[model samples]
Target chain A: MDVQTWTYLLVIVTFALYIGIAIWSRASSTKDFYVAGGGVSPLANGMATAADWMSAASFISMAGIIAFAGYDGSVYLMGWTGGYVLLALLLAPYLRKFGRFTVPDFIGERYYSKTARIVAVCCALLVSFTYVAGQMRGVGVVFSRFLEVDINTGVVIGMVIVLFYAVLGGMKGITYTQVAQYCVLIFAFMVPAIFISIQMTGNPVPQVGMGATLADGSGTYLLDKLDGLSTELGFAAYTDGTKNMMDVFCITLALMVGTAGLPHVIVRFFTVRRVRDARKSAGLALLFIAILYTTAPAVSVFAKTNLLKTVSGQPYAEMPAWFKNWEKTGLLVFEDKNGDGLIQYVSGPDNELIVDRDIMVLANPEIAALPAWVIALVAAGGLAAALSTAAGLLLVISSAISHDLIKNVLKPEITEKQELWLARGAATIAVVVAGYFGINPPDFVAAVVALAFGLAAASFFPAILLGIFYKRMNSKGAVSGMVVGISLMLFYMLKFKFGLFDGGKEAVDALEADWWWGISPEGFGTLAMVANFATALLVNALTPPPPEHIQNLVEDIRTPEGAPPAGSH
Target chain B: MQLPTEFCRLSGPARMFTFSGHTNPDNMDQPTRQEHATRYWNANLRIMAVLLAIWFAVSFGAGILLREWLDQFRIGGFGLGFWFAQQGSIYVFVLLIFVYVYLMNRLDAKFRFDR
Candidate 1:
């Protein structure tokens, strides 16, 4: 079959499978809706968490970003993965022991204040919305490119599928479907990578193939050859970093803390049976994620090497059909500067070819002349990634509004049945809002997505960490710390990233040299998080300690035994 | 640093006392239960501190701070630092979590806190 036919068949089949799972696992009560009735097995929860955590960006764009950025991309590779260590050791087991429905529930009861709960809900909404908008956009982009539909129509289709599961079956449905997604996405990512690896280095493992000599009997290592080609073209060597050391340090730290704090990821642990399961599931989740994370840099090396060899100094008229296909999509552009027909794929202004970073993964199969079915599989995989993450984020957003706001703060006397209806209603609305953002994304959507991590790092991580570890952390301190931290992060992000203080988007690039402490705005979360820790500690010193029962509650959570089944309270 | 020895000493006597006659933790007095809880909490903290130190050493120290120096040494075609930044640290992180799980479970059993 042709690529188009294969793409339609695979996309339809996968969507049907997800919808089938959703129907099979339909939630029956508020507990089922929120935490999958807290009976999820450790292995299943681990796979579900892996699917929820690896978003569209991880599936589609990370390898491409690494291909272009070279050694500097290590910040993302380390930053994204290291947070699991924090989660497994410090956060997950304790949060699971707390046995609550939502993150704000822990904040509310631990701090013994409704105000703290409201603050947490607001922060959760802010972070999840900013993050989900990008996922929705990712879905739209994949649909338009692969399914040959309008982007808005694609977004509507995505929203419909998510609403069907999330509004009806809730977490139970989402969990099982995400497991299916994890399988689809991992298989899709590995197949093309293995094929390209063997083609390039005669090694089946992409990880090993990246370091091996070329299959053409060149007797030179792949990295060494790439370094030579890069330097010859006036670009930095593939193994040498060009970013400032401090900036890399701070960005890695920010992303790590942010990952640990994300509500969607943390909530996954609550679905498991016990504290031990929570810890074990976190390990399993990381193991599953590392399969792709470790292979990405290797994919980057292979793709980059392939791109340079195929396109550099080649005649535009003689370029492959995949190159022309991508060019028509407007993601690849070629200009004949000086009226020369030869493609000048170079680093500087004289360069005549412009390639979008996303094409590395999206076009890899086509570029390698792999089977048409594999290309279609990538499209389905990208959709699965975007939809799974979107469903997870939507659940968080809905829970924040229905469980945290309406039920807890607004009307505590509502019946469980009424609350369930409200949760579904809230989810439906969240999906619409997310779809709207996807269809009519603001100019800053792409830029603001990274700031969601910054917001999570600044606001949630310190609050949740202190609430767990320090028995004396009072509501006043937490409220003050979160307010200061989020405000500082927003201020830096606006001033530097959006150039709100100086000029607009056009001037933002020029403002880089004036960065505070040589750290980019993307890395400012580390500083803000430190400020939060300091502020909370200072305020706690002045305020009265938490009530005696609250300290006892911390003690109860510290022990792994006697954790009430999640949501039993 | 002194925590492991202190934990060992405390746990040794505590285990003996429990085995003698006080197997039912629910019957213990408030202060005695609080003491048991404190010992368990302290042991958990010590383990966290040690594991987190190794986590920092691998990712931040080897991966970033000493990356340039470590780049002089190559494993296969990868620099030691580059491998750590991209591959090695992630593998170590997975291992660290399992190790924590194993140690904490044993600690839970020792403290009679295991379900």
Candidate 2:
């Protein structure tokens, strides 16, 4: 079968499977809707967490980024995975013991203030909305490329699927469907990688194959060869990075803390049955995620090597059919410079070919001459990743409104049935807002997504950490710290990333010299987080200590004994 | 690590609120139950401190600060520093989480808090 037919078949089948799971696990009550009835097994929760955590960016864009940036990409690899350590050791187990429905639930009850909860709810909404917009855009891009549909049409299709499950089954439906998504995405990711590994180095494991000598009996290691080819084309060596040390340090720290602070990722831990299960599930989730994370660098190596070998100095007229196909999508361009018919893909000016970084992953199978079914499978996998993460974020946004705002604060006397209906209504509205962002994305979508991590790191991480570890933290300290942190993060992001104060987007690069302490907007989160900790500590020292009951709540959360079933409170 | 001890010392007023009146049906005294909880908390903190040190060392210390020095050596075809940045550190992170889970579970059982 053709690639298009195969894409349609696989996409249809996977969508049907997801909808089927959603119907089977339809939520009946607020407990079921919010925390999946608080009975999910460790392994299943692990799989669901993996799916929810690995958004379209991780699945579709990360390897491509690594392929182009080379060693500079390590910031993402270490930054993203290292956060799971913080989650398991510092955050997850205790939050599960708190037995809450949302992150604001912990902040609200722990600080014993409605104002603190409202601040948390606002931060959660901002972070989730920014992150979900990126996922929706990713879904549209995949559909436009593979299904030949308009980007707006693709986004609407994605919105409908997510709305069905999220509004109907809530966390329960999202969890089971995410389990199915994890399977589809991981399988789709690995098959092409393994095939390319065997074809290139005669080793089945991409991890080992990346370090092995070439299969052509040249006795040359793959990295050594890529390094040689890279310098020959005026690009930096494959294993050497050009980014300065301090920025790398700051960016890595920011991403790690941000990953731990994300509300959607934290909410997954609440679905598990016990504190121990939360810890175990975090471990299992990382183990599952590491399978793809470890393989991504190897895929980067293979794709880069193949690209250089195929295009550099080769005749453009002799290019493969995949090149022409990708050219029609406007992602790959070739023009003859100096009237030469040969392609020049060098980094300097006079280069004749323009290759988009995203193509490295999406076109890997075609570049490696893999089967049609394999190419189609990647499309389905991309959709699964985008839709799963979108569902998770939508749930967080809706719950913040229905559970935190309406049920808890606005009308504490509302019945369970009314709250559940409000939850569905909020979910439907959230989906529409997310789809609108997808169809008409802001010019700064990527920058905003990166800033979402900074926002989470600055606001949520410090509040949650102090809430658990410090018995003396009061509502005033927590609330003041959050406001200071988020405001600082927003100020830095706008000035440097968006160039709001210094002209506009075109002036962003020219304004880099004015960066405070040489830190980019992306790395400013670490500094903001430090300021938050300091502000909280100084403020807490001046203020009276928390009441005795709040201190007892901290002590109880410290021990793992007798964690009540979630939502029982 | 000393922070927790200092906080516990300052939390004398918090001791008036005890789990003995409700959670502990063993007829244990308030002081004994508080001591048990404090001891368990210290033990968990110690384990976290040790593991977090290793986590920071592998990713930040070796992968970033000492990367140029470590690049002088090779593991298979991988420069030692590059391997840690891309692959080795992620493997260690997964290991660290499971290790924490195992140690905490055993500690919970030891403290008679595993129910």
Q: For each candidate, report what fraction of the true interface contacts it reproduces.
A: 0.84, 0.92
Best by DockQ: 2
Model 2: per-residue Cα lDDT over A422-456, one tens digit each: 99999999999999999999988888897888899
What DockQ does every candidate get? 0.72, 0.76
- DockQ of candidate model 1: 0.72
After superposition, the stretches of candidate 2 with alpha carbons farther than 4 Å from their true spots are B1-31
TM-score list, all predictions: 0.96, 0.96
Candidate 2 residue A293 C-alpha distance from true site, Å? 0.4
Weakest lDDT window of 10 consecutive positions for candidate 1 chain A: A338-347
Candidate 2: global Cα-lDDT? 0.93
Q: In model 2, what are the clashing residue pairs, if there are any?
A: none
